[model samples]
Target: MNSAFSYNFPALRGVQGGKEYFVVMVPLRLIPKIFLFDEEEIPPEHRSQRILNKSRVPDITNYMLENSKEYVFSSLTASIDGQIEFQSFSDNPNFKDLGNLIVSLDSKFLINDGQHRRAAIEEALKISPELGEETISVVFYHDYGLSNSQQIFADLNRHAVNTTSSIGILYDHRDQLAMLTKEIIAETPLLERYTDKERVSLSKNSPKLFALNHIFNTNQKLLGKKKGEFISEQEKTFLKDFWFSLIGSMTEWKQVLDKELNPRELRANFIVGHGVFLEAIGVVGNYLFYNYPSDWNKYIEKLSTIDWNRSNRKDWMGRAYGQTGRINKTNQTITLTANLIKRKLTLPLTEQEEEMENLLKQGV
Candidate 1:
């Protein structure tokens, strides 16, 4: 028998101020691919709260092992008003990043959890000095004190109380969404350090558009079916096909963008449109790939013949929904809008183009 006994999953939902709440449990596996330290170089704090160094780091792993089954795979709501700070503890080594994670002597700086990850951060810094300056999650307890923080930590530590609610579902979906964003950012050297707040803001402010991008760009295996739904291995292969096609298509659009658009204004588009364009590419990429087109530019010329916008907005939206949008229904309006965007990429734009009419409204 395993050393630990069976325990229920933790309740992700709870109440505060007489109001019921939930915190979504986003499995690490579901987290969108992000750049992480090499496993050997990961800090102790960065290790899963469930495993590290034969349990030398701390006992957070024990809780996960014994009670992960009981933890509700849902969202929880707690008024989160703390900051994530990463401090380095080094003795003036030539490499600033090789230092340990330093928390000030202030009891307020006590770790709520994730000590191993912190250690890994130090190790990463040694190899890549730029990493020494990254922010990590933590809950400050200066005002609340150790007891309150510990209670918060204990609740987080508890793995066998899975009582999740509807709101919990939303939170969980939101987290999955965030993980996807992080994965994309990880690949872009220019955008790696973008804050979670910025990423969330971009998605929420334009949920439908972003969702369309996610569907078109992500691997099918990585796709989230809904809050708490487990991803299957088959879907992952599909997602890979989708990601490659989408990236290839973006190469053409980026050239178009460079000629007439301010890159920043198009940030959301690049974020969202990359996926939509990829879907369009997938629609025709197999043909192009097999034919061995000598020039990508010629392929773009060929793509220009396909007019997605020939259908009315409502009908186009219906198709997008029927296809990629079906998995996790975001907003149909945004989904439809994204399809039109694909048309703009593949077809010629009239001098008085459709995009001009909506661009201002969308803050694009």
Candidate 2:
């Protein structure tokens, strides 16, 4: 007789590709005991799925523990390498479809996907034992062998794609900066109508000058704020005033607002229509606000006099545009453009800015 332990779980039986599977909800406390990672190093001859990344386990654990109240996870997928049996209580055919799934404890259950979540749940339970009461959905498939499990892993991840940053910002309400960016974009004159709502970068033929994420990042730089940092009402007001004043000083922006110039014409003719210039302007604004809070508006007049045309190679070639005639997004280019704005405004550079200037002087 085979020595075995058995677990009976309420399950729904389903079939796909002529194979049987079970969908079951298991309590968090039982996860560690039922599913094994088999995380040891394997030689090439015995290798199955890619080796588990132990480094990522702690981060995922912390995410689960921190967001325990609001956290949501998709179903965990696993495969069992033993016989499984199902029994139903009622005689009705519909009732027969819903039954208790009994799996031999002697069966080897290996996670084909969601090993990170499995690790995280084990870690989280160590500190927050009460979480054991919560349940997670699991999909169980009978395992054929190593090659089948490896194929399952490959098939699971083959089409996975991450959401775009602009779309993330557009939908995120948890981030204060993203929230403020949307409001600010809605209020800014030319920006309100011309900003791309769901992309990080715009195509040459795109009608918008800025992407939602670009505007959010530029505002973050402008206020010297880190991502997800809280913004005070005073800071919000200051940001609004700063952007309004800066836009007011740009003759081209005013022309577009007044319908005197087409947006495409401005985009084709100037570097200011790109994200690099906008972010550089934000960096300059950040410096001026920190150093000259009471008189920063005075420098807005000087911005109008600086040539912003993209064809002005002497001013833009090495700063905003590279030798290949495309926008260069390197930090060096942004700093160089900010330095040009500082020079135009006659503002003294900070020690860090001075170092950047010296680096550029050395042709680095």
Candidate 3:
């Protein structure tokens, strides 16, 4: 490391909500030097106020590498704990004006937020060195002490909320599964009117029976599509046909589609209206399409015989519902539900499915 560490950043100084801070565009190459990640494992004697999540670093690094040219990140929040001097070319440094902020080599910079992004950038640069030329915005505040730094971290994260999956699908044009889900909802008669478009879960009294996010995820699982993978036209058509045939065999779904019943009533009375059952249907359909494609429709009749109402405790309680009668959506429950559907259709289980059945029998 160079002993004489100095950076002259063109910055704007402003007061936000009664606090003064500087915003500067920083090159990626200088990020690691200027900001240090306060990991959880660091000893208390050398620890800063910030807590770094090392587990998240590798995923963020992989995302950075995968979407290098198309990625966008929000501004990083940092605190400077040393001599900070601001030199203004203008006559009044107090007003909003262009200035040069300089920091001494002895200064300590601590990140209050965006430590994962900083670590990811460092790791990404090792594989793609040209990324060093890219720049990210950094917001700097003068550090008072550990207390103030901790408070800053708390205040910054207090109101953060993650984006919902359904909204992500609705607005995303990059994911092929999302596009296919939208098309299926538009074309499939049973799903057309009862699919919630903007949320991941439905309210009990909501007119919609299922969430668009669930349908997208189900299709992804059925088609064996990973995140960021493309879907072919044939696969999309197959998904449409599979969902149409499967829902056609579901009598309750048909009643709702034919205006003989209300979706809210169906949602209240049956488990089939929920996303978990739709996912189970997708799993069963995927299995049949792969193993019994020539006569997959012949097994569709089995879905009608299986009572899908939540009140059918003998059939659904231990498989789809917990002992308390609430729906269980764990992977174990999903596999068990698919196993029940498979047994009803007289379909043979794969090695993994048999293992799942054995685990269920052991009360797992």
Candidate 4:
């Protein structure tokens, strides 16, 4: 293969399983022409390629365009079936690991993962050709025929796991709701002491009162904030005051705070102890926050009057606990549970809540 017709990159050489791999930074413009995700999955081997989920590509493309100034993406993984060579910059031992990696233009490239990102870059380039100068990294592996490449794909994905929602909320800096949720936890000693900052579901004896994601989501409900909306300092203060006042009203939570009751048993047996009711209470607060303004704390105190036992069949059967005798965590259950709270507090129900009640009464 002629050097003039080869793809060239300043690549960092690495080794794994006693084989060579190279990490190269590629200009966005060359990615589509070189990888060609829309074309077919290759190695031209007898193997099934994971179909590109076309719907997902548009969202990723939009994300790139919207956050062009500050967007971040992980390196893409690819396998190259071509003649390859590395040209060292100098005889200096330090320069040995840094060099131009050259691959023949006739080589076939196979994406073992990140097909959506590749497709998205292609779509984005059509609209924002100026972004062509920007670069993305690719980790390239030498294409070994059918069996070896298949094994590489399997090993690459076998141990992969999606980050849990709570951890996502914990680490996200851009979303206002996530930041607000973190502030709420940091400001409240009770939450800081008992919140599960990583996982969503808590084991019965895990000693956590709420998951970080639950606090994030319910606060979104409380403020009626849409995605990407900014939270004002005044609103942040209101939420801070609201949580403290609301926590003050819950006797069992206070019991846990004072160590009078076991948090494990409380979480195990009570509706007030769960995030479902926090959301219901948040919905109730949305009305009170907007309607009562100065007197919402008094209305929040009314929570003390409700029985929070999971065994309260008449109140929780279809609200927090479903017909299956298990706690329900769906959005419908959150609203239905809010309806029950509204009734207990003698607060008027929204037309939508009334409609939901009517539908339930008619068994719809």
Candidate 2 segments exceeding 4 Å error: 1-4, 38-67, 88-96
lDDT of 3 by residue, 274-339 (tens): 877877877888887788877888898678988888888877888888888878677777778888
Q: What is the TM-score of each candidate against the true structure?
A: 0.28, 0.86, 0.89, 0.87
Q: Rate the local accuracy (lDDT) of all candidates.
A: 0.36, 0.83, 0.82, 0.85
Q: Which ranges of candidate 1 are over 4 A from the true structure? A: 1-181, 188-197, 201-224, 251-253, 256-261, 265-330, 334-364
Which stretches in model 3 have alpha-carbon errors above 4 Å? 1-5, 43-55, 92-95, 230-233, 358-364
In the range 1-364, model 4's lDDT, one tens digit per residue, is 5789998889999999999999999999988888844245544456525668898998899889988999888998988988999887788997788999999989988777788899999999999999999999999999877577667778888999999999888888877778888988998999899899998877778888888878877798889997568888878888999999888889999999899987788987898777788888888888888998888888888888889988888998877877887786788889999999999989999999999999888877
Q: How many residue pairs clash in each candidate?
A: 51, 0, 0, 0
Clashing pairs in model 3, backbone N/Cα/C closer than 3 A: none
**Against the hidden true structure, what lDDT does model 2 obtain?**
0.83
In model 2, how large is the Cα lDDT of residue 103?
85
The window of 10 residues in a row where model 1 has the poorest summed lDDT is 1-10
Best by TM-score: 3
lDDT-sorted candidate list, best first: 4, 2, 3, 1
Query: What are the candidates' C-alpha RMSDs?
Result: 18.7, 3.1, 3.1, 3.2
